[model samples]
Target: MKAWLLNDFGLDNLQPGETPTPTPKPGELLVKVGAVSLNFRDKAIVDGIYEPASVPKPLIPVSDAAGTVVAIGEGVTRFKVGDRVNSHLYSTWIDGAPLPDAPAHCVGMPLPGGLAEFMIIHETSAVAAPGNMTDEEASTLPIAALTAWYSLVDYADIKAGQTVLVQGTGGVSVFAVQIAKALGARVIATSSNDENLAKIAALGADALINYRKTPAWDTEALNLTDGLGADVVLDVAGGDGINQSVQATKAGGKIAQIGFLGGQTAALDLMPLIFRQTTIRGIAVGTRTSFERMNAFLNDHVIRPVIDTVYSFDQAREAYEHLTRGAFGKIVIKID
Candidate 1:
């Protein structure tokens, strides 16, 4: 089988070559991949910016994919051969509760991931794909969609009539807007691009802020809520945006910190946090259980993933480059 292997830490070291096909061990499933999706984390790992749970060389580097089961190991009763499935990005975190430590046995980092023709997944990590989605659409669910679902639904518990603010038009933010709306929350999306903002509005977002035009988007968001601020803020921007998120959140509101897309480090003011009793929670990818819940929601609501583009399996490097270039939605790789 041909797989894209990372011989060293840099993107320059990524090369395509033949590798042995993996067989399923007990409690594992061997999937013949149909498609794989790229996330910002993939770019970070390739650029040596992401540090895995453990240090090693020669890693297969992508977590999110959709495939058909070709074989299943002993004790695997949830699925069978010929079933279509997707693996959760964080394979070891099976529930919504916080892990005992950082680096929760993440796929594409410590473990071999989905960037190959054949990949093995534990039974615990597999979830059925949503009924209405194509393989390309289903591939985007494991990382971005699951992360958004965990943050908005599991952590924040955003409810109907609540105002939820989502930052930017990245993969997670797009999913956040959709899921928040699906949960009966009023969604407010922010984007630097007018085109993307228009697209977000079409996806049931009640309000849209062009962050570029309105440099003080946080204040505008507050004003839109009648000076009360949003009930929940899904924040992907990690630096000074944290301070903005805190300020834009209403008293006792929750902020789910999900990524460092803006910048990793930031100076924070604790005044709003102390006075308003704000709750700021850090969110990792998600648990396998959350992935299952998200799949159920997708199937019930007929939610479809937004894909920016699709690349052939052999064009994996180009797909990675496209993600780094800030594609508006999820980038997918057709593996079969």
Candidate 2:
């Protein structure tokens, strides 16, 4: 089998190598990987910046994948041969609360990932891919799409006719917009690029703000909602931007803290948070059960993942580069 290995912590170190095809252990499944999706975290892992002390050298580095089950180990009953499945990012968190060591058990970091032609996944950590989607489309669900769903549906308990504010045109933000619209919520999307804002508007966003033009986009959000604020805000940008999220959210509304593109550390004011009783929920992908529920939603809504680019298996390095260059939605690598 052929796979890309991160010999050291750098994009240049991610080179293709030969490895033996792995056999599934008890309660596991050996999958023929059809596609692997790149996330912002994948880039940080390659740069040795995301918990570098824990990431192992010569590791496979991608968390989300869509594949076909070729063989199932003994005692595996959840799925059988010839099933199309998506890998769960949190390999051990089956349902309910996450495991204490969920970060250590995550795929593409401490655990081997699906960058290879074939990879082994615990049967409990795999979910049936939506039948309407292709492998490349399904590959984006495990992290980006599920994070959006978990944040809006599970954390916020979003209702129809509510207003959702999503920041930027990144993978998770795009997914959030689509999912919010599918659930009958009005969407407000923010992007520095007017072109990207227009693109998101085409995807059913009720309002668009060019954050670059209007630096105080939070105020714009309030204006869009008639001096009230968004019912739910997806705060993909952390750091001082958290203050903006607090201002953009309506009283008693929820804010999903999903990413740290701005920066990790933040010194937020306590006054507004207390006054508004805003809930800032931290999202770390989601559990396997949540993934299954999200898949059902995708199937019901017929929501298609917005793919920005798809690279061949041999172009894994280029795929990572594209992630850094930024994209409108997800970037995928087809494992041929």
Candidate 3:
């Protein structure tokens, strides 16, 4: 089988080559990967910003993929051979409250991942692909879609008529906007480019803010909300952006902190959090249950993932480069 292996913990070490195909262990399934989706964490792993759970060698490099089951291990009954499936990005975090030790068991970091022709996953992590989606669309769901779903549906409990603010036009933000709209909530999307803003509006965004022109987007958002601010803010931007996120939310509103795209460290004022009774929750990629719920939602609503571009399997490096260059949607790599 062909796979992209990290020879070492650096960007320069990510190289494509051949590797032996893996077999399913007890309670695991072997999937013949059809497509793999790239995420910001992929870049962080290659750049050595996020270290793997343990120091290892010859690591396969991706977590999100959609494929058909080629074989099943002993004791597996949830799925059979030839079932179309997408596995959770973090296969080990199964159910209930997140374990304090989750970071150590994440896939793509410590464990072998999907950027290969074949990969094995525990049967507990595999969920049926949404009926209406293709392999390319399904590939985007395991990480980004699940993250947005967990934030909006599980954590924030977003309801109809509420206002949800989605930052940027990246994978998670796009999914957030679509999901919020599907749930009957008004969506406010922010983008640096007017073209991207226009695109977002066409995708059913109630309002669009060009952050490049309106540097004080928090004030703009507040004005849009008639001084009440948004009910729920999906804050992907970090650093001083956290303070801005606090300002953009209504008193007693929620902010789901999902990423540090702007920067890691931030100078934040705790006064609003104390006095205004604000809630800020940090979210990581979701568990298997969230992934299953997201698929069910997509199936019921017939929602499709917004794919920026599809690259051939041989162009996996190019796909990673495109992600680093900041594409607006999911970057897909087709295997078969």
Candidate 4:
């Protein structure tokens, strides 16, 4: 089998190589990968900057993939050879509160992930893809989309007629916008570029804020909400901007901490929590239950992921480079 291996934990360490494909163990299934989606963490893993832990060497590095099951282990009853499935990022956490090994159980990290033509995962670690979704679209559900779903639906108590603020144009932010709109919430989307903000607006954003131009985007968001502030704020940036997020959030509103796309380890002010009574929750990607629920929501709403670009399997490195450049949506690699 042809696979991209991280011979070492640096950007230059990725090399094209061949490896033997493993047969599924009992209670496992072998998937012939049709597509894989790149996440910001994949770039961090390559650059040796991902914060969860140092890069695991000699491994395939992508968590989200969708493909057709070609072989199933003897004890696997839930899925068959012909079923279409996508990986559910966490191998241990099925649902509810996360476990201590949740981060370690992630694909592309401590375990082999979805950067190759085939993957053998435990049957419990796979979710059936919706029939209406293309492989490329299903490939995106496991990580980015799941995180967004958890932040908006599971973590936050968002309701119709409420306003939700999503930061930037990345995968999670875009999904938040789409999901919030589907739930009848007014969306305020932020981006540095007008072009991207325009695109966000076209995707049903009720208001747009160019954070670069409007340096005080929090104040702007508050003003747009008629000074009441946003009912929910999906803060993807974890740098110094968290202060702004707190300011942008309404009193008693919810702020779901999705990711630190801007930077990790920000100096925070606690006054907002004390005075405003806002709830700020930190979240990793979700459990398998969240993954399934998200797929059902997507299928019912007929919402397809906003794919920014697609590269062939051979262009995996280029896909990583493109992901590092920070595109407006999910970046996918299509396998033959």
Give TM-scores for every candidate, taking all chains together and pairing residue i with residue i: 0.96, 0.98, 0.97, 0.97
* Residue pairs in clash, model 2: none
Off by over 4 Å in 4: 51-54
Residue range with the least summed lDDT across 10 consecutive positions in model 1: 51-60
lDDT of 3 by residue, 137-202 (tens): 899998899989999998899999999999999899989998999999999999998888888888
Tens-place lDDT digits, model 2, residues 60-134: 889999999999999999999999999999999988886788998898898889999998899988999888899
TM-score of 1: 0.96
Which one wins on TM-score?
2
What order do candidates take by lDDT, descending?
2, 4, 3, 1
Question: Taking the tens digit of each residue's C-alpha lDDT, what string does model 1 give over 1-336?
Answer: 889899887777899888899889999999999999998888888888887436356888798888899999988998999999997776777875767763647778778889999899888878887767888899999889988998888888888899999998889988988888889999889988999989889998999898889988989999999999999898888998788889889999999988998899888898878898999988887778788888888778878888999999888988888887777778999998
Pick by TM-score: 1 or 2, better one: 2
TM-score of candidate 2 to 2 decimals? 0.98
The 0-to-1 C-alpha lDDT of every candidate, in the order given, reads 0.86, 0.92, 0.87, 0.88
TM-score, prediction 4: 0.97
Runs of candidate 2 with Cα error greater than 4 angstroms are: none
Compared with the true structure, the alpha-carbon lDDT of candidate 4 equals 0.88
**lDDT tens readout by residue for model 4, 1-336:** 988898877767888788899799899999999899988878877777775355566888888999999999889998998899998878888988989868877888878888888988789879999899889989988888898888888888678999999999988888888999999999999999999999999899999999889999999999999998999899988887888999999999988887777688888899877799988888788889889999999999999999999999888888888887889889999984
Q: List the candidate numbers ranked by TM-score, top first.
A: 2, 4, 3, 1
| Candidate 1 collision pairs | none
Name the lDDT value of residue 218 in candidate 3.
92
Would you list the clashing residue pairs of candidate 3?
Answer: none
RMSD of 4: 1.2
